[model samples]
Target: MGRAFVYVILGGGVAAGYAALEFTRKGVSPGELCIISEEPVAPYERPALSKGFLLPESPARLPSFHTCVGANEERLTPKWYKEHGIELVLGTRVKSVDVRRKKLLTATGETISYKILLIATGARALKLEEFGVDGSEAENVCYLRDLADANGLVNVMQSCSSGNAVVIGGGYIGMECAASLAINKINVTLVFPEVHCMARLFTPKIASYYEEYYQSKGVKFVKGTVLTSFEFDSSGKVMAVNLRDGSQLPADLVVVGIGIRPNTSLFEGQLTLEKGGIKVNGKMQTSNDSVYAVGDVAAFPVKLFGETRRLEHVDSARKSAKHAVAAIMEPKKSGEFDYLPFFYSRVFGLSWQFYGDNVGEAVHFGDYSSGTFGAYWISKGHLVGSFLEGGTKEEYEAIAKATSLKPPVEDLAELGQQGLNFALTISKKPQPALPIEVSRSTSGLVLEKPVYAWHAAAGLVLTASIAGFAYWYGRRRRRW
Candidate 1:
């Protein structure tokens, strides 16, 4: 037997969850939509895997960190999906996708057909095997990507509490996990080849602020080197990690976050690829009209930068998914997916938010010694990006708005001197359409945007509330 649906979302992650919520919000009919995911549970916030999920106390779990909920929206639990008549084929992977036939063949020997398709396959974490290292499958070795990976990591962390843990990678995953492990009382030694952590996004000065804080917590940094091999015990557990610098860090557990590869294998040759991901238009629609891609798999135009980028972050995933749905539902009035990239992370007691691109010259501002400080990236004589640490919702919004405006940077020295004052005054000159603010709790751990700071989580809330959707042609024609 086969199942037919008006809309089928392939892959259930953050994007799938948010898309399902949007569908329900726009008045979807029962049995009209289905989400096929490899995970047994419905979509949850994937970031928690590296942050709250590994905490020593009140570790985040299912339903608690569900998608949309983080945005202060209704959490889409499996029960909720059932109530909405949305099918969830969890624990089933799509073996192949026939875009022309509008059918997806599952590894379970099931064929599902859809009048319209949305691909939210997301991405897979890079493995140690790919980096010439072995024993990633060891019991103590962990990689955080989804619920299962997080659960496995928590289990390993618990068993190896107060033990030495080696974390590979210096990006978001590395920093956040390193903090979590330290809080859990595990000795953390972070290894990355970058001169400092978060090299791609953070300036040397900004990176120093975080590095100092991490150092205070006894987190060691092994920079400018990569993991070469792993020493495993007879039980197939990684006991230590050998690095390229001819050094070895003893490890009771390993948390790897080198990078991720977009899960676009199924769509190879079936869709146009760009920037290492499936290329899509502003609508997030791929080469095929009936098919759309979102999350880490779709490289769409970034109107803010006048270029295309494949952003592997939760904000892009949620926004792109919702945008694609809106476009499919109402092509004429859905509007273009003009999104400002927002990324944030909470490690220990420090939280930071970044908006726009990190290209061009950077200007440091605020007191670096204190908790509150930031920087702005100027590209082609425009403030194209902003980074803020320990900022109020209003302050964060100021920089985000100012940067997105591509505000002219007349003098670098003057801009540096003014610092936050420049961003604070930017909106008053030329108001950003639908301005947003970034906010969080005083603890500096709760990443919250009180109002329109539609950067990431809060933006998810604002966007969902007013996605400006109309009626899907296929659904309207079928149900009406």
Candidate 2:
């Protein structure tokens, strides 16, 4: 048998949830939209899987961390979808897709047709087996990705209480999971081939601060080494991990988070691919006019950086999904999507936020010992990126605004001396307001002129006219 929908969203992820919300907001009728996902439950914030969900006490659960809530919007729970009359085809995988026919063949021998489609398959976490090291199937060897993975990790954590735990990789998952394991009273030994953790983003100087903090928390670091093999016990549980440096560490539990690969295998020949992801336009539309892509699987153009990038962060997924929906529903009103890259993390009592591209000369500021420090990246005499820790809400906003504006820097020394003040001053300056547009009615009467003004101090926009004035607040774009 076959089913049909006016719009269909593939891959139940952050993008899919946000797309569903946007579609409903744009006045989608009941039964007109459907979301097909291999996940058994509705979409929840994926970032939470690495952070709050792993807490030792009262960990975050479903419905609490569902979609839209991450953006401070209404939470889209399973009930919410039902109330909206939106169908959620959970635990169902699309075996094949026919873009020309706008049909999807489910794994269970069902054909689903749609007029328009959104692809948000996201990515899958890389396993140690891919690196040629076996024992990934061991009961205690865990890799966090979905709800099932998180639940498995939690069970392993509980079973290995106060035991030695080995965390592989130095990326977001490794660092966050290590912190969680340490908090759970487990001896955490984080091993990675890089000289330091978060090698892709944090510089040596920035990494030093976190390394010191983690050390103080009893988390050991084994840098410049890779796992060559795993030693398992009679019960098929990982007991130790052998490293490339000719070293072996006792491991009652193993958590691997090397990296992720975009889920683009399904559309390899059917769609244009770039940067290891499906190619899409500013509107998130793929090469096929009726199909679109978003999340980690879509390599859309980055206007600020002037290049196509496949961002594997949740913020891009959410914004791109909403933009795609807007473009589909209100093609005449929707403009090109403009996004500023953002990333953040929280471990123990520490939290930090990074905005814009990280390139060019780096300037360090603040005191590291006191737990307040930040850095600015200057490229071509303009501030291109800003990173801050232990910053106030307004200070974070100032840095984000300055990074987006790309304020000119005359001297590196002066910029360092000025520190956060520079961003604050730049943020204080007023932005050019959009010119008021006026139109005439068919009766030759002048219609009310609409004034579009930016409120810099509040980071909001005011749309005023003879009829009324409405304030539109901007949301902070953040990724895990």
Candidate 3:
């Protein structure tokens, strides 16, 4: 059987790791996989970097933590690929793709060839090019796509005062950024052109709940507003922000956490794109058989959503990468990765968790009136999604398993009972350990490990002797 081949994965993030894991699981040793990432540091979880880590200190506020990139903050070293025998190339950029030749030209004039390729280049924060910042005026505005962007924001926030902050969008990142600024006691004014927060993904009721929840905590919302340009002071600092409505607000610092677009310019027209993300089939494979894309880069079709949409969730990348890897290893066998979307955020001392599509008629419980409780999104009387505050790990895992099972269970009470019952009955699954291998190959060629057959035979003999002695002792005990 063919042993190994160079599986070159571009964009080292969650999806790439999944592909690597899948390859390893299929017995393609570590030396055969290679990953290239542009970022200097290895990939880390992007969610915690902005929300949990960016806590600010104040009397009304809780003790703050330094958030915004850097895996060291959480002691999460990027070791998945390295431990799996995958060659990782960091601080490198791929300039172009020669798909026919199966080669990638790096910006540094180096060409790397691959038998199978994966493009998980993901996406970059979409910048409002028409608008400008006050203090440091540059086209390269601040974004949180990578660690470097997070570092830059942290440095800028160090000297930020409690003046006025003009946030461009009311999306998740923008809202999270606004919440972070408010916690810092910064006079934050979130500008949203829409009537409600997260209107695209959330209903008016949920959006209103989030709006009122944050508003009570001193976050000011300037609804139905849009920014036209940025006004700076004599010192070249952003002094004020100008809106399209002939209105201007005094601003000391600004964070435009609007949204992001896929970074797929290198591929040009080689791959397919639906709404700017590369289009992938059910198996997480792209139009090109040998080329695959995952994470934020691939625009996948969600069966529940009934339409193709690009999911920016962290878990999506991880799962999709695994499916891609499985497909690469067993070309004849089909694999599918479809999981309900899950999102969580911590704001105002509340642990908020939402799962699946947050649309449809929501069957709610607990108390939104009390700013606490749980709610489930019900569509056609089917439990589609859930929104919760203050749920335990048991609840989290139960919900996950419920979503994974077949013959969709409709009874909420039964689901909860089953969830709790399973939690109590089953021992928690152990985390899988990384495989050990002496040598691996990258060109579809397997390298032999230095193991002597004599040593194995001696070990087998030792095992037999021990078993024989144990059997003899058992017989003596029976006779007694």
Candidate 4:
């Protein structure tokens, strides 16, 4: 009976790990399900290592859940899959996939036949040298992706004294690394080619708030500048960064948090790619019939943005894994994963929470000077995105409600508690003027005090209902 079936899972990220669990629960006997992981170590939490693990000031370690064992470790690590009779081929790379033959060629010169295959090969960080930044002194410059990278950065941080550390790119990872270094009182200078941080994802207003937050934490920013070249000291360590402009930055430690690239060369002409990312529909299935991709590799669709953008967020990976599993099990009945992109980052003492994809213009609802407030993004007369800085549950709920619906445009002249009420109501009558753009014209404006929690809970439930309805509709469509 066991010989009648065999399923192979390639890649070792969250998608591969969890999808294996899903297969087991469906009564696929252990011998029938095989997981081949490229990484020698079992899967562990990746995000914590970069922020909490590297920071000496932080008491954070790997989470107790899903503990992984390294290959060298001789603890006879209790294998959850082994107990269930599942086979785990560790430290093995899938050299090639013969999809037509249902075969996987491994680096160890072994041929494994699979009745079904799931490709969760994920991505790797694009090396700085790949971007044409050549220097033998990349020894001091570090990139964060895995636990090894985090541990290496920790060592680099300890070896260097309080000198200037230059960070290239102002994306989420870059900003987080800068904040982590600053928490240890290390002088950090961040440079981004864009005028503002996270320009590709956030509005100018929300990016400004982040800029102010980083500045308040003593991080110096060199906006609108790109790294043109890297200079090294006599000791083979990076010492300076030349900018696209006629300026250069002195550096002791340089951290590159630019972005990540999907590892897709293994499936090179076999899969469809969008701008170099693997293109997958809502079900997380690749162009091929039996192959499905998830995590950083999958170019999934975002309903709010009306685009199939690839997201690298942790929650996105989790959701996409489930979607991929469903597609594999019930391809004829599997539903798509539709989740609003949610992200949270802590810089200094402030927690910035962003919900939904930021695709529209921003609307500021609170004061920015006090280092606390929230902003909403309205897209085509509907709430599409929001960011709350040092926000309360109620503020988050309001933003949740804003994103959950296509509420009519609000009158800027009538904003506040009354304005929120007015926003809830749709206006059939033609507006007196086409939507006007209102930016934060003033730098300093004393705002009113915070509202009660009752206001937030009410808004949260309403938004939850809308989400529930959408999920129900998607599931219903899958059944049909």
Give the winner by lDDT.
2
Estimate TM-scores for all models. Answer: 0.89, 0.90, 0.74, 0.78
* Candidates in descending TM-score order: 2, 1, 4, 3
Candidate 3 to truth, TM: 0.74
- Whole-model alpha-carbon lDDT for candidate 3: 0.68
Model 4 lDDT at residue 438: 24
In TM-score terms, candidate 1 sits at 0.89
- Give the runs in model 2 whose Cα sits over 4 Å from its true position: 433-480
Q: Write the per-residue lDDT of candidate 3 for residues 186-278, one digit (tens) a residue.
A: 788888899998876666776788888788878888889787777765656776778877888887677777788888897778887787888
In model 1, what is the error at residue 291, expressed in angstroms? 0.2
The sequence of per-residue lDDT tens digits that candidate 4 reaches over residues 1-480 is 112237777877666666766675566765787778876765555666656775666545544323222112222222676787777787888788777777778888888888777777777876767878776246778888876687778878887767778888898778888988887778999998898898777677778777877888889999887787888777878889898887988987889888788888877877788756788888877888777777777887765555688887766776777677777777787776666777777666777777775655666666668767666666555566667777666655566555544354565434433433333342222433433322221322111233456667877999999999999999999999
Residue 410 CA displacement from its true place in model 3, Å = 11
RMSD of each: 10.7, 11.2, 14.4, 11.4
lDDT of 2 by residue, 384-448 (tens): 89999999999999999988877778899988888899999999998656554445444322223
Clashing pairs in 2: none
Model 1 per-residue lDDT tens digits across residues 1-480: 678999999988899999999888777899999999999898888887888888888888887888888677998888899999999999998899999999999888889999999999999999989977888878889998988888898889889988999999999889899999999999999999999999989888888888989999999998999999988888888888898999999999999999999999998998999999999999999999999999999999887766788998999999999899889887898987889999998888888899998877888888876788888888767788899999988998898888766777879889888988899998668543664543333422112222544456776776766654433555677898
- Model 3 is weakest, by summed lDDT over 10 consecutive residues, at 60-69
Q: Against the true structure, whose TM-score is highest?
A: 2
